[model samples]
Structures are given as C-alpha cells and as structure tokens.
Target chain A: AQTVTQSQPEMSVQEAETVTLSCTYDTSENNYYLFWYKQPPSRQMILVIRQEAYKQQNATENRFSVNFQKAAKSFSLKISDSQLGDTAMYFCAFMRRLNSGGSNYKLTFGKGTLLTVNP
Target chain B: DAGVTQSPTHLIKTRGQQVTLRCSPISGHKSVSWYQQVLGQGPQFIFQYYEKEERGRGNFPDRFSARQFPNYSSELNVNALLLGDSALYLCASSMRTGGYTFGSGTRLTVV
Candidate 1:
C-alpha cells in the first residue's frame, strides 16, 4: 500500500505572493504518478497539476508548478502570484502506473492543507 | 462536452437506512470511480468500474457496493448506513489513461 503525507495543516499567503505546500509519500513502486487537487467551499475536487515519476522534469501549469524529488519521495506544489481564488483545501495524491490487465488508477490522498490566500 | 455528473447533490438519511447515489460519466469515457470525503479530510477511494465491470475496490466494507451500466454510468449503494458514513461522495470519469475529471459530489448526511 501507499501513503501520502501533508505536514502542513494550514498555510496563509498574501495575494500576488508565492506559496509552497509540502508533500511526501512512501511507495516501493518505481513508476507512479503524483498529483495535487484543490477543493473549495463548493466541495468540488479540482485537479491542479500532475507529475510522472519516470520523468526528471517537474510539471508546470501556469502559476502552478511542482518540485518533485523522486529519490527523497518528496512532491511539493508551488503557487505563484496567489489570488484569493487559490484559498482552499489542497490534497496530494499518488497513483501507481497502469499494468497490463489490472486497474491501478485509484488515488491515495493525503490529509490535506488548507491554504488561505489573504488579500 | 459535459463533465462527470452526480445526482442528489445533498441528502439526509437515518441510521441503518440505505442510500443509493448515481453518476454519469462524460461521453466516450469508459471508466468511473467513487470516493468518500469526510469533513476536514481528503477523499478516500471507494470503488472503480470499467466496461461495466468491477476493476478495483478500496478497504471499505461489503455494506458498500457499486455497479456500472452499459452506458458507463454507475451507482453506489450503501446499506445500514452509520453516522460515520455522512460525508461528501465524489464521482470521477476518465479514459484508459489520463487524469480524472471529478463531479461536484453528493453530500450524504446520516443523522
């Protein structure tokens, strides 16, 4: 089994600034995927960004980027030019690589970090 | 195109009662998965269906069951619901390989 950990339970950042949320995982599998999801007050889980373990290059989507250290099992999310819309509960998730005939797409998530982007 | 849609945005049930939640995947999507999110916590995987077959299951008990239809839609049924079952239930759809698109989720409050 796999476990994802988000050490920071809560974090606050001023608008237009940058914030980084930490995440770590324990997995023996060599190939896998890491993800960051945001849930707002509406209770909808939205995908932020994703990283593939096989790739050394981290993933970037606009203002959202990831610093993935595969050897140390660390995957952190950095939000630049933060806005009030970024205030939400962020979760780190992990999924194993797909096999030939089995399903391994189920995501294992961390407790979550509530981010408050103050104006 | 429409994303994943889940029915009964919110509901209240009594203890030991039964509840069924519905989900409709996006067009052409053949995979649907369910998750439970408790207050102040992240979502937990419950079940996954592909091609109208059970593909994966989480550590939930047998009281939690689900099935998929030919159209790739799915239903999750929970029997003898307990207070702990009160939470947000999310449904997601995906292709064979890619990130999942999640629904707004059904809030089940077991009183």
Candidate 2:
C-alpha cells in the first residue's frame, strides 16, 4: 500500500509570488504515478500536475511544476506567479503501476494542504 | 465531452436508512471509480467498476456496495448509514489507468 503525506496543513502566498506545497509518499513499488489535485470552494477537484516515478525529470504544466525526488519519495508542487484562483485545498495522490490490461486505477491521497493566495 | 456527472448534488438520510448515488461516466469511458471524502481529510477509495464489472474494492464495509450498468453508468448504494457516513462522495471516470476525471461530488449527510 502507498501512503501520501502533506506536512503543511495550511499555506499562504501573496499574488505574483511563488509557493511550494510539500508532499511525500511511502511505496514499495518502483514504478508508479504521482498527482496533485486542487479542490476550490466550488468543491470541484482539478488536476494540477503529474509525475511518473520512473522519470527523473519533473513535470511542468504552465505555472504549475513539481520537484519529484524518487529516492526520497518527495513530490512537491510549486506554483510560479501564484494567482488568487490558485487558492484551494491541494491534495497529493499516488497510484501504483498495474500491469497492462488491469483496471485497478484507484488513487491514495494525502490529508491535503489548504493554500490561500492573497491578493 | 461531458466530464464525469454525478446526480443528486446533495442528499440527507437517517441512520439505518439507505441511499443511492448515481454517476454517469464521460462518453467513451468504460472505467468508473468511487471515493469518499470527509471534511478535512483526503478522499478514500471505495470501489472501482470497469465494463460493468467490479474490478476493485477498497477497505469500506460490505454495507457500501456499487454496480456499473451496461452503459457504464454506475450507482453506489450504502445501507445502514451512520453519522460517520456524512461526507462527499466523488466519482471518477477514465478510459484506462493513469488518467482520471472527477465529478463535483455528491454531499451525503447522514443524521
């Protein structure tokens, strides 16, 4: 079983500044996937970024990026030029790499970190 | 093009009562998964159905059951509801593994 952990319960960042949300996981599987999801006040969860455990290069999507340290099991998300829209509850998730033709795509998520991007 | 759709945005039930939550997967998606999210906590996996078959189940009790229809639409049924069951129930759909689109979720309050 894989477990994700977010040490910061709440984080605050000013608009146009940068902020990083920390995450770590414990997994025995060598190949897997990590994801960061944001749930705003509307209660809709939106995918922010993803990182593959086997890949050394971190994933970057627009203003969202990740620092994935496979050895340390750390996958932190960084938001550059943070905007008010980025204020939300951020959750870090993990999924094991099942064999091809398997459909067990369940995700294990962390408690979450509430991020407040102040204007 | 419609993402995952869950009906009954909010529901209230009494203890020992039963409730059913519905979900319509995105067109062309054959796999659907259910999750339970409590306040101040992350979502917990409940069940996963693919092609109208049960593919996986999480640590939830047997009182929590679910099924997928031929159209890939799914229904989650919870019996003997307790106050602890009050939470947001989320449904996610995907064509395959690694990618998932989630619904806004149905808030279930058990009194």
Candidate 3:
C-alpha cells in the first residue's frame, strides 16, 4: 500500500507572495503519477497540478508548479503570486500507472494541509 | 457545461438506518468513482464503476455498496449506518485514464 504524507498541517502566505507545500509518499512502483488537489470551503476538490514519474521536467500550470523528485519520493507544490482565492485545503495524491487491461484510477491522498493566503 | 452533479446536497440519519446518495457524471464520461472525506482528512476511495460495471472497491466494508446505471449515473447505499459514517461524500467522473472532475459532494450526517 502506498501512503502520502504532508508534513505541514497548516500554511499561510501573504498575498502576492510565494509558498510551497511539501509532500512525500511511499511506493515501490517506479511508474506512477502524482497530483495536487485543492479543496475550498465549498468542499469541492479541484485539480491543481500533476506530474508523471517518468518525466524529469517539473510540471507547471500558471502560478502552480511541482518539484517532483522521484528518487527522494517527494513531490512539492509551489504557489507563486498567491491570491486570497487560493486559500484552501491542499492534498497530495498518488496513483499507479494503468496496467495492461486495468482501469485503476484510485488516488491515495495525504492528510492535507490547510493553506490560507492572507491579503 | 455542468460538472459532476450530486443530489440531496445534505442529509441527516440515525444509527441503524439506511441512506442512499446519488451522483450524475459529466457528459461523455464513462467512469464514476465515490470517495468519503472525513473532517480534517483527505478523500478516501470507496468504489469505482465504469460502463455500468464495478471496476474497483476500496477497504470499506460490505455495508457500503454502489452501482452505476446505463447513463453513467451512480448510487451509493449504506445499510446500517454508524456515527462514524458521517462525512462528505464526493463523486468524481472521468474518461478512461483521464483526470477527474469532482462534484461539490453530499454531506451525510449520522447521529
């Protein structure tokens, strides 16, 4: 079983500043996918960013980027120019690559980090 | 376009009772998955259905069961509910091997 760990329980960043949330996971599979999800007060899970283990280049989406270190089993999300709307509970999730004839899409998530972007 | 839709936004039930939650997947999406999000914790996978068939199930007990309809809509039923079952139930839909679009979730409260 794979387990994701988010060491920081809560994080706060001032508006227009940058903040990074750390996440690590335990998985023996070399081929996998990692994702960061944001859950707002409305309780809707939104996809923030994703990274493929086979790709060394980090994934970037607008103001969100991930530092994926496969060897270290660490995948971190960096939020730049943060806004108040960015405040939410951030979760790190892991999913193994789809095997032949397999439709496994289950995501194992971390405990989540409550992030507040103060203005 | 409307995202995933979950019905009965919120419900309250007592122990030993039964409850059913409903979800409708986005158009053209063939896979629907269910998750339970306890307060202060991330969502946990409960079940996954694709093409009206059960594809995978999580560690939840037999008390938790779900089925998908021909139109890709899904229903999750809990028989003999417990207080610990109180949580936000989320529904996600996706094309095969694609990213998921999640619904706002139905809040289930068991007293």
What's the lDDT for all of these models? 0.93, 0.92, 0.93
Error of 1 at B29 (Å): 0.9
lDDT of 2 by residue, B29-107 (tens): 9999999999999999999898888888899999999999999999999999999999999999988766688999999
Q: B1-111 in candidate 1: lDDT tens per residue?
A: 998999999999999999999999999989899999999888999998988988888989999999999999999999999999999999999886557889999999999
Model 2 steric clash pairs: none
Highest DockQ model number: 2
Instruction: Find the 10 residues in a row with the least total lDDT in model 1 chain B.
Output: B92-101
Which parts of model 1 are misplaced by more than 4 Å? A97-104
Residue-level lDDT tens digits of model 3 in A43-69: 999999989888999999999999999
Question: For residue B18, what is the lDDT in candidate 2?
Answer: 96
DockQ of 2: 0.69
The local distance difference test score of model 3 is 0.93
- Residues A1-119, model 2: lDDT tens digits: 78999999999999999999999999988878899999998887888888888788999999999999998999999999999999999999998743356766779999999999999
| Fnat for every candidate | 0.61, 0.67, 0.65
How far does residue A24 in candidate 1 sit from its true spot (Å)?
A: 0.2
Candidate 3 stretches greater than 4 Å from native: A97-100
Score candidate 1 by DockQ.
Answer: 0.65
Per-prediction DockQ comes to 0.65, 0.69, 0.67
